[model samples]
Target: MAIRRQDILAAAQRILSEYGLADLTMRRLAAELDVQPGALYWHVPNKQALLAELADDLLARVPEPSSRRRWDRQLTQLATDLRTTLLGQRDGAEVVSASRASSLDTSHLGKRIVEIVQAGGHTHAHASASRDALLHFVIGYTFDEQSHALMAEHGAAPARFGDSDAAYAAALSVVIAGVRAPTAGRAAPRPAG
Candidate 1:
């Protein structure tokens, strides 16, 4: 039977999950697929291309941003969804950071995020910065979470709750709180004892 592109990508994902991006060599992939290493060349030009394809495929699974809510909530939902997805797979955020927004589905998602920000009565520049801030924050946060997952796999407690909804609420609360305007020079929140 002919080798399929999806099969190659899926194999790459599995290998990345098992051995990490560093260990996923073309020869190893061929061994996994039970074919010659050259077989992958027909589907992807090089290791970088294979990595890019894997990133693209993984990022494509992030659900589209919705237009149904206040911009803050919409942005929060998008960021939280991204963080959750990245945490689900090994080294997922690292893979995402290596790939450009232009090279993967991220650019589309970024555009949607910016559109929501703009629609919320912000200036173009403000909306752009807002979108970037959220994206970078979530992506960075997810990378830390992925690292935590790796630790968890080694029998440590990340101790973070497993429920996606609750995690989102906790994270978004902090992130959205940061985005708020200064309270007209009001008193700062009291420090915890």
Candidate 2:
């Protein structure tokens, strides 16, 4: 059978799932695929590229916004979906955060999010800011939650809030309210003359 890029990615993902990001080395991945490490280079330039691919795969799982819902509700659902997707895999949030710092195409997700906010009567700048803030919150919150869960698995104390769902929901509500406030019949202050 021909060694395809997808084959390499699949093996890489399996390694990531079983061993976590810290252990996902080129040597280990090559061993997992029963190929020379050089062979992986033909498919992915390096380990960072492979990680970027994994991060993209995770983001791709985020469900599109529902058109029938109000903008704030859609944003809420989007944030919830993001958290769900990040928590689905071991070290998923780390992969995403690392990829964001790499040369990956994460703008599509951001564009969709901004569109949702814009639909709610926000200016483009405001929408973009709100979208970024929400994305940052979701990633940061989930990353911390997953890290603590890992600690708990190793016999650390249970999480203070029991789980992240309620905390995340409350935080998301605050962010959405802040984003919606300026548009809800309050005008921006004029620049000082």
Candidate 3:
């Protein structure tokens, strides 16, 4: 049987889920695939490359923005989808966060997010900043969320905010507001009773 890149990635993800990120080394992955470590290197040049691919895979699962929705609503949906995807896998947020400072190609999702904010009347710089802020916020929040889950799994006290949904929504609202605030004449009004 040919040892394919997809097979290696699948095994890596399984290792990540079953044993967490620390246990997902090339040697272990090779053993899981019944291939030699050198053979795995042909598919993924290095551990960082493999992790970048995995992070891209997770980001690919985020739902695309709807063309019919308002820009703010679209941004909201994108942020929510991002958080859900990160929480879907063990240590997924860590995988993504680790790749952020690298030159990996995240243009697919990044382009769409910047487009959404730009459509909301932000300057290009502000749009890019907003997208970065939202992604960073969600990754950090979900990392903590998963950390709490791990703590609970080990019978330790879970550090938690109020309701997860409410907290996320509130924080997301702040991000959206900040993004919208810089538009010259289109600042959203405060909610009234």
Candidate 4:
């Protein structure tokens, strides 16, 4: 049997699910696939590249934003879907965040969010700021949520908060409201003559 790129990805995902990100190292992955560590480079250039690919694969599970929906609704659904998708995999949020910081080509999730906000009649600068805020919020929220869940699962600590789903929705609504603020699209006023 030949070890293909998908095979590597599959093994990496399995490693992630079964052992979390720390155990998803290149050497461990190579061992999981029963190949020399160098063989992985034939398919992926390095650990950072492999992690970026995995992050992209995880996010790809999120459904595309609906055109029929209002832009705010689309933004909300997209953020929720991304959070759900990240929560579905172990250390998924961490992987995506790391990939985002390390590589410019990893995922277009932020870009899509910017487009959604722009469609809502905001300037590019406003839309971009909104996208940054929204992505940071979603990713940071999911990372903390997952970490808390993991800790509670291992008896390290009880879940820190109650009604997380509601909390997330409420916070997202606040962000969307900020995105829709009247001044969001307004340019600086010219000084009076």
- Lowest-sum lDDT 10-residue window in model 4: 102-111
Model 1, position 53: C-alpha lDDT score: 84
Candidate 3 Cα RMSD (Å): 4.8
lDDT per residue, candidate 3, 1-193, as tens digits?
Answer: 7797789889999999999988889899889999888898778988898898898899899888798999999989998998999999999988887776564225577788888888877789998888778777888899988888888889796566568888899999988888877654676779999
Task: Give the lowest summed-lDDT range of ten residues in model 3.
Answer: 99-108
lDDT of 3: 0.85
Error of 1 at 121 (Å): 1.9
Clashing pairs in 3: none
- Best candidate according to TM-score: 4
* Top lDDT hit: 4
Evaluate residue 109 in candidate 1 and report its C-alpha lDDT on the 0 to 100 scale: 68
lDDT of 3 at 30: 88
**What TM-score does candidate 4 reach?**
0.90
Model 2 residue 127 lDDT score: 84
Clash pairs, model 4 backbone: none
Q: How big is the positional error of residue 112 in model 4, measured in Å on the Cα after superposition?
A: 1.2
Model 3 spans > 4 angstroms off: 104-106, 159-162, 183-193
The digit string of per-residue lDDT tens for model 4 on 77-110 reads 9989989999999999999988888542225777
Question: Residue 33, candidate 4: how far off, in angstroms?
Answer: 0.7
